[model samples]
Target: EFYTQPVQSSVTQLGADIYTGDNCALNTGSGKREVVVPVKFQFEFATLPKVALNFDQIDCTDATNQTRIGVQPRNITTKGFDCVFYTWNENKVYSLRADYIPTAE
Candidate 1:
């Protein structure tokens, strides 16, 4: 599953922000499933800022045996970033609660 949310500036750090909320993806197969959730920012920066995934706060449910969840940032742009969620099981649902950290150019 893949989705996006509106950017909220009031809930962000000075240079960082949370562009998405509660984005979830489900793995219905027995192998690793990867889903890419797109996040939009308020403004386009001059350079690509550093992006990070808050994996510690992730909420996963209905996971199979030996299921593992992983997250990462990819295809980053000046305007937004992609939060990639990975799961290693069938019928596993991974919820994302990611944060973006902007770096000084």
Candidate 2:
């Protein structure tokens, strides 16, 4: 038999913190920025867990522009990790949601 625990989740904003400077071009059609949002686990696990991200809401200045967005896990630890939200050719992002689960198997 297998058992699972409750999933931990969080929401973060884009184009904020570390997304400025040379990493991103202001008021430009072509730009790439990476924003790191720190996430803390509700319950610590013995081993590193897995995480997932999804776009809840996205806002951009250029309606005609095809924006690109992505998310990944960084600095993974048993306690928590940072969720990196990245985008290219986009102006802004409203919100992003992240979910995590702890499982060694």
Q: What residue runs in model 2 are displaced by over 4 Å at the alpha carbon? A: 1-30, 61-63
Candidate 1 per-residue lDDT, tens place, 1-105, comes to 989997644223232333224544453555677777777767777766776556546555653345477768788887877778777756455455455554435
How well does each candidate superpose onto the true structure, as a TM-score?
A: 0.61, 0.58
After best superposition, candidate 2 residue 11: deviation in angstroms? Answer: 22
- List per-prediction Cα lDDT, in the order shown: 0.60, 0.56
Error of 1 at 98 (Å): 2.0
Q: Which digits, one per residue and each the tens of the lDDT, describe model 2 over residues 1-105?
A: 999998975432222222222323333445786667787766676666655545544444546666667767788787777878776664565444444443442
Error of 1 at 89 (Å): 3.7
lDDT of 2 at 35: 66
- Candidate RMSDs in order: 12.9, 8.0
lDDT measured at residue 89 in model 2 versus the true structure, 0 to 100: 68
